[model samples]
Each structure stands twice: as structure tokens, then as C-alpha cells.
Target: MQSKIEKHVMLTKKLALSAVIALSLSACGSGGSDDAPSAPRVQNITYEALPAMLTFNEGETVRLSLNTKGEGASGLKFNWTVKYLNQDVTFTGQGSDTISFKAPNVDMHSTMQVSVKLDEANSTKTFGFHDQHLSLSIKDLNPPTTPAHELGEEVSEIDTSVLTTGSTWTETHKQNSRIDQVDSSYNLVDSTLIRSFIVESADQNKQVVGTNYCGFPDLNSMELNASVLSIKCSSGTSSTQYFQKENSFSIVQKCDETIVGVSTFEKKSNEAIASFGSLNMQFKNFADLQTKEVCAVVATSKVTAHSADNQEVAKEEATAIRLVTQQEGNDFELHFAFNEAPNGFFVSLNSFFDENNKATIISGSYPELNASSQSGSLDLDAKNSISNMKGTFNFVLKNDAGLNEAVEGDFELVLE
Candidate 1:
């Protein structure tokens, strides 16, 4: 019985083997099998750019990608690089399917480029490489732009409403002062001033100016504009005039020469006068900056305090100015002392001389100021950013109440 069962099983196996052999022979057909025929496919590789813009700006993040399409796209490899003026740019990501890089600065005369090499990284046979390259132009982002001037409903004036709401515009002027006992120096007191205005939806452009920037009351009586911000606000006896724009503001204070023991007045006369003042600051160093403006770094020392005649004691080292030199690609910040003096008065002048010598004046004392006998000049080399300031000043430190001690001296600033 066991032998009969084994014979039956053997017969079944033999039958199964014969069937497989017959099927294999039929598959061979008339054509001898050399290799399997490939399916119909397109040979070209397609890729899309993440950012379609051909012309770019500095600091813009750029990316390139090879999208899946056609035959063997998944097997494709990418070699990527960015260049500025032919120099390799810093980039990120594995150079396989996609890569990214930030646009670097391009000088006015330079060019930018992005290159990618597409090929099969892994293949048994040799294949030609497909190279993709892009040459583009990038705009420099560090350079200052000319702000747009909007016209008010009234023609011939800037639209003050266009001014950013709640934004306080600050103006700094550097010019010679007029007070004989206060701000005056042929060279030293040229660049030191502070002024400002706040933009409002409802008559925020109020003027604040006085004699020597003395004092003023608020009254929106003066006519001004949105494109050109000018406000007239007088507190009481003194009249105030303030003008503002997108980037700067000007405060014109009509000085009352009759007022004494107050801050210095503007242009006591047509002639220049001897003047001086002690330099005080709100900041301890470059790290400190409370107010939205810059104060000059004035030298004060009992040892170097010189006298301009007799009552005018601020001279030479007493009010010698220390300024930060201009640097490329960095905002030129002149170290200033924003101090609230004993008499609640502070004076500063500024002249920002760029290619056009765009200079203005700013004063922090007595709230407002007027044009001086000497209009100051500043040579600001502002190519990439606001640069250094070089000028002279004459100042005085008044302490008549016998409350606070007089601080006076020489100062020289060197920033590397």
C-alpha cells in the first residue's frame, strides 16, 4: 500500500515539471531574448525655480528644485552653487534634489549667478551631464532710499497724514550758535542740535519752537501739509514752528532775547558771539541709548577748562568734541550724551553731509530754536550707511543756583 502511494506522488511531480518546461519554451517565441525592452519615455529633465523673479535684491532667499517628471528623474542628482562676481556664495542643503542660498551684496558694477549640474549620480554606464545656469542682477539693500513725498490736500506741501501715525520724527542739526555766554564756536559748536514732531490722525503736527528754542504753547493755528509737515503750537508768550517730512523734522523757535536765566536764544544779532557749555550725556557708553537721538561726546575736565574771555569759560578742552569715524556697511552713529542738565536744558547740533551734503540742525534745549548766525556744515560720507561726523563747537555750563556742581574738560574718541 505504501509503495502504491509513493508511486502516485512521483507521477504528479513529473506532470507538474513537464507543464513548466512547455510554458517557458512558448515565451521565447521567434525573437531570441537579449534584454527586456524599455518602455517609451521622454529623455528631457524638467525643473522649476522656487522664486520666478529673474532680478533679485540682496538678502532675498533663493531656491531651485528639480521636479519629478519623465524617465529616471528620481535617479537624477543636483550640483548647485551661487556666485557673486564669480565668487562662490555660502549655501545650504544637500545638493541632490533642491538647494537654497541667500543673495549677497552686488556692487553697481558686479553680477550674480546660480549654477546647477544635473546628472545620474549612480549608473553602470557613462552618461552626459546636463548643466543649468542662471545669470542675474541683484540690488544692494544697504543703501538708503529716497523716501516718497506725498502731497497734502493743499498743494505745495507734504501730506502730514501720510506720515506714519504715532511715529515721532526726530531732526538733528549742527550749526554755529548765537549766544555770547552759551553755544558759540567757529569750529567746535558747528554740529549740535535736536528737534522733533509726532504724527497724529487729528492735528498731531503741532509746532514747538522759540528763541534759543526757548518755549512755546500748543495751538494748531499755523498752516502746514501732509506731504510737508509744518505745525504751529505756542504755549504762551513764545511762538513755535515745526516742520516734518518722511525722514526728518525741523523746529523753528523764535527766541525772546528779553528772557533771562533761560536757555540760550537764537541769533542775538547778525554778528558771532563767544560761547561755551559743559557736555552732559544720558548714555553711559555705546551700549546705552534712551532717547531717540544722538548727543555729541563732549570732553569735560576741571584740568582742561579754558576761558573765552571771563564769564564765558567753556573753551578748548572744556567743550572739545569726540566723534566716531565713519565706517562702511555700518550705520555711522556719532556717540552723543543725552543728558537732562541741571537747568533742564540740553543743546545739540547736527549736519549730515552725504553726496548731496544734506545737512540740517537739531537742538534739545528750551524746546525750540531758530536759524543761527552760522549755518553749520557736515561732511557725511554716506555711501553704504550714515558715516562719521567731523566739526568743532563752543559751549558753556551754567550753574547759578549753587545746587549742582559744574562739570567741565577735553575729550577725544577713538572707535575701532
Candidate 2:
């Protein structure tokens, strides 16, 4: 009987211990709930009227709408304010959730701070008031008044009919000049040079006469059309030049002055070359002692020529041709040859000249016969006190075997 009584006492103690643990857990789970209702969670608070970030021009209106996701938001009140240009301005919105105002004008780029306050304690069960802020960029909208001329706009084609033989045109102006020295690796060393000059041209035989500062060899011939006036000039080879009628009819001489015509030549010519093939070449040289540091190789050639019958004699897909030049002490030599000679009739022009002198074609034959003759001129222009140089080439290929070809072109290369 005593053993049974002890067993009953142990069971009673275990039951009391379990009951104490259960009470402790219940108190921990509802520590503050027994006194008052728990605070409601606030979430998804955001603006619906304006974007997170805003951009506007001065005098533009901006609108804002406030939104929230949770219970007890009906009694919330919103107070709006804007801080602009070091001053703060408060706004009254009649207890509405939306705010609207005009952006203030600013002299330059500026920013404004817009903020809203929500009275959550008075209107909802949330812990306290909520604050939201946004940044707005206000930009000046006035247009810029610089850049007097519109670039890349097509102008009217020049009327070349009135440009009769012996007719002369002249102009003078200022322009920005750029000089670039490139190394063999195509790295460029550049400088800006100020240049000025006077230019005059006559229609007869297309002779161009001007001061040494603006000298261009006399044009061998000129062709006029409804939209373009193409001029062919020879210095060492043949140079076929074109001017768009509708563009800036201003003639640029020695890459210096840009001349505008005081009087317009309104006559148009019916005869014009249909097409001229393209020429491509490149020049590579080193600008300094740096290895692999090379100047931009000038490898560009384009020519549009028509036969006497006005038929296109040159096609875009013809065999490639190039003009290469090398410096030999105080003299320079230029070679013109086909990348792939059409036949044994390969024609080449080897011209050499010194500084401040015209290039003379020394040797080259078309038919490889004694009667074959070749002649051409290369006129070098030292621009910006020898900062750079440009040369014009005009060559005539004549063979006793009935082959005759005239080539004219120009190239610009760095002096250094």
C-alpha cells in the first residue's frame, strides 16, 4: 500500500510540472496581446501619381498620387512640401491623396525635392507617421543660338552654262584648319592651324589663278551639268574634281579659306561625264620614334571620267590602281601603276621633284617602244608653314602603237 501511494505522488508531480511549462509557453506567445490589440503592419506604401523620379521643364505641371496597401488607411492625412533652390514651400491639398504643382523656372539645370508626410497614428493602427520623398530634375528649355550654318544640307546645283571661257570668279573668307601627323601604326598627332587665302578661277581652259597662299594648278578641263561642275586638273597626275550644286558652293583652296560667290553662275551645261571610277590608296609613315606608332596611311582614290562621246569609260569594278610616293633626301618620287597590269601594255609614271618645285615624269612607257612618250606634272602645296602638304598629279600616256590615256589626281599627306 505504501508503494502505491508513492507512485501516485510521483504521477501528481509530473502532471504539475507539465502544467507549469504549458502556462509559460502561453505567456510568451501572447506577452502583449492580453493588454491591447497588436499594431497593424504597414506595407506597399508608394506613389501612384508621379514616377519615382521625375523630369520636367520649367513652367510644367507635376502631379503626384499616394497609395498604400494595408488596413486602417482611411483616416490617414497627407502633408506635401517641395524644397527648391534652397527654399522650402509647404502645400495644402484639402486632405486629398493627390498633389499637383507647377515646376519653378530656373536659370540652369536644377533639382527639387518633393516630400509627403502621412499621419498614420491619427488615422491608422500603424506605429507612427510615414515619410516619402522624391527628386525632380528641372531643365532650362531655351534653344541654343550658335552654329550659323546647317551642316550636311544639300544646296542647289551650280549653273555652269554662264561660266564661259575667260569668265572669272573670286572669293575670300576665314576657316578653321586642321593638321594631323600620323605614324606608321596609324596613330595621329594633331594640331589646329589658322589659315587664310584668296582664290580666283577662270572658265577658259579651266585655269585657276590665285596667290601662293591659295594656289591650285590650272584646271586642264571642266565639265558642267545640271547639278554639278566637274573640273579636271593635272599637276603630276590627273585630278578629277566635283562640286555639288546644292551644297555649300563655297570653294575651299589650300584647305584654308572658304569662299562664297558674290555673283551666281546660272547657266547650265548639257554635256557632262556620266561617271568616273573610284581610286583608292593609302600612305603609311611613322610620326615619332615609337615602334608601331604610325600615321594614317592615305589610301583613297576616286575618279569619274567619260570618253569624248560622253560614254562612261571607267567602271567601279575595274582593276585596282595606286599612287605611291617616297622621300629621297631632299627630293620625293611618286609611282603610279596598276595593281594588276591588264596586259604586257603595263603603263607607269615615275615622277620626282624637290621642295617648292613641280614634279617631272622622268621615265615610263606604255608600249615599251622607243617612240612611246609620257609626261605629267606634280604640284606640291606646303600648307600652314609646312605643317602638311598636298599634291596634284596630271599624266598623259602616249604610245606609238595607238594607246593614249590621261590620268589626273591629287593627294594630301603629312609632312613629318
The global C-alpha lDDT for each of the candidates, from Candidate 1 onward, is 0.31, 0.33
lDDT of 1 at 405: 16
Residue 227 displacement in candidate 2 (angstroms): 34
* Tens digit of per-residue lDDT, candidate 2, span 36-66: 8655444333334334456777788877666
Root-mean-square deviation (CA) per prediction: 29.9, 28.8
Candidate closest to the true structure, highest TM-score: 2
Instruction: Please give, for residues 1-416, the per-residue lDDT of candidate 1 as tens digits.
Output: 12221221121111011111100000111333468664323244444533322556677887656553545555555667776533567887555767777877632212355666544433222233335556555655543222223211212333344344444333333322222112211111223323233333334345222111111125222333221222221111233333344343333333221111111112222322111112222211122222222223332211112123223333321122323222222222233231112111223322222111111113332112211211222221122111122223322222243322121222222110
Clashes of each: 57, 50
Q: Which ranges in model 1 have alpha carbons more than 4 Å from their true place? A: 1-45, 48-53, 106-110, 120-130, 145-416
